[model samples]
Target: MCRLALKTANEPFSPYEVLQAMEAMKEGYDGSGLGLLLRGMEFEDFKYNPRFPILSGIAHSRKAEQRMDEYMDDRGYELKYDHRFAMNPEKMSGKMRYRYFLRAYRMPPAFKDRPQEEREEEMLRTRLDLRRIGEENNGDLTVFSFYPDVAMIKEVGWPMEIGEALCLWDGQIKSRVCMAQGRQNTNYGINLYACHPFFIQGIATMTNGENTAFVPIRDWLLGKNIPGYIGYQSDSEVFAHILHYTLRQLKLPLQAYKHIITPLSSRELETHPQGDFLRGLREVCRRLIIDGPNAVIGTLPDETCMLVMDQKKMRPATVGGRDGAWAIASELCGVDAMVPDRDPAFDFQPMREHTVIIPPDRKELQIWSQHDQLPLPQAA
Candidate 1:
């Protein structure tokens, strides 16, 4: 199992803070890599830019940078501003470490006034094509995320060291919501691409346990016409894919995702008041059911964030914080690292077969069990 921690708030918070939280649970992971996805950014130049795709990625060599520019222009993307990472790490030596590059682009003017859905599809498709191009060419590049306000940084190193080297406390970078992971090499060899906190479009996810159900899930996603579902370096990446397929492709709600991956038996489903309604959902998405010891936390496209565990509850997770900010972690100490003085009296563990949902704007955390997840009908 790896260490997973996600911190989200109404105001911008540093990813390094979450990295420190992952460090607090260092006993669980060896720290082969660190991955961070930040949303609702406050970067000085990027924060004020008009609506456009802001791409953040890793370029292994000089050739990779040139390759990216050519590919983007060839694909009808106009380069707006290419802002290089500004970091001068004193503790580390040798060629500025890994450069986290950000480039803002204007969609071809022709795409203007198109249905919102078409624009989203094209953005995701082009990003996927770029990743494939980068990987096949002599240059090795992985564009972590390509949404308007989201920025991601991933690398091969200790989480705390990477965080400190990047200077997360610095004012230049920050986000209102961040999904972060510290990789502990277990089932596969270490590769920066295999790191956690996988992102697709606006959806991002990190898991603390293995996904035994990954193969079937992968196969199902591949069946779709989707192009971005190419890499599966880490089995947990499928969890992020599952979220994308359910919401983006199938057009379901976030709670429906928890139902897809962690469904209850028919008899158990009947216990909920909306068993009849849930039955329809179960029948349609049964193939998406997961079989494993896993706990997942993620942000949906709508900004509604969630934390859930498999029916077995083999994984450990704790949720704690006050209104306006919340932290989810594989262990209690991880949460403590983010919100130091959070009311201990207010903290609680999400039981097996349940999910904790924090609405897009509200600070309160709500629960939806495997039984009856839908809101109750209003009084007549």
Candidate 2:
């Protein structure tokens, strides 16, 4: 007959603890009894959330096989038994018991892919490249947390509330900067968080000279000693300090440019101090176009394009819009919206992909155009 005893304890058993317990039980018994002890234990008794049950069972199984091996070595016995509790002492020997236990508790298969150390080294190299790019571009860049599309926040688990709070606060700071800079003339706006499969847009701007920069106003607020829930809230003031230091180092032409950096919540806008700032920014944009004609509107590449096509008036068949229109929006979306429908032949392709018209002289009506095409390098 099989004898099973379930231990009741408030504290859960770890895998090591379970292995120790099994070892203690094996001290008195030979191979004949050790296998029975293992098979008889009610695995359900050790079950607990997270860790206890699964690991303990694994430990118990390993301990049983080890004890059987020790018994076989000492006694030089071969063990035999029926499927149930029929242990014939004459037919069953220690050697047979060891073999039986070995078969029952085989080790799991090994992983086939690259070693973890190699994978980690690869990841480290990639991160280094990212850091170098950011540094070369004057610390202007966006970092995003990427996840699979099928993965839900609740199902996969994430700190959604905390993330939203930080994003909203960031947005507020950006909107304020946009308002102060004059949106219409400066072409400043916020960028949406890059959450899609494509590249992240509107994090930082790479200047014509290849130097990178972010919105100054948002960087300034991040440097203030303020109570907030963002991850870097404690070092907010440091962020601003870094921005100033970087700008000074780069010797950028800040006086000629206005920029804003707003954060969008998923697809929609979030409410916060930043939201109010964006409202003020919109008002500024409305006023600038109404009053100023020669003002140089500067915006991030994407926003500049968006504003030109969506909000400004443009001449028919013109590849580029007037100063005010292109100042705010300078992307394909902006350019497409500005051009009149009468010229079906006039199509606006990507500035980088196609040739741009360069006027030879202020008097000459004919424009010189050339396409500088370069093939994309093969990915490594």
TM-score each candidate: 0.92, 0.16
lDDT of 2 by residue, 287-352 (tens): 111111111111221122111111112211123333221111122332233222224243342221
| Model 1 agreement with the true structure over 73-145: per-residue lDDT tens digits | 8878888777655564764432343457877788877787787777777888887877888779754777777
Question: Top model by TM-score, which number?
Answer: 1
Residue-pair clashes per prediction, in order, are 0, 21
For candidate 1, give the lDDT: 0.78
Clashing pairs in 1: none
> Candidate 1: where is the Cα deviation over 4 Å?
88-98, 373-380
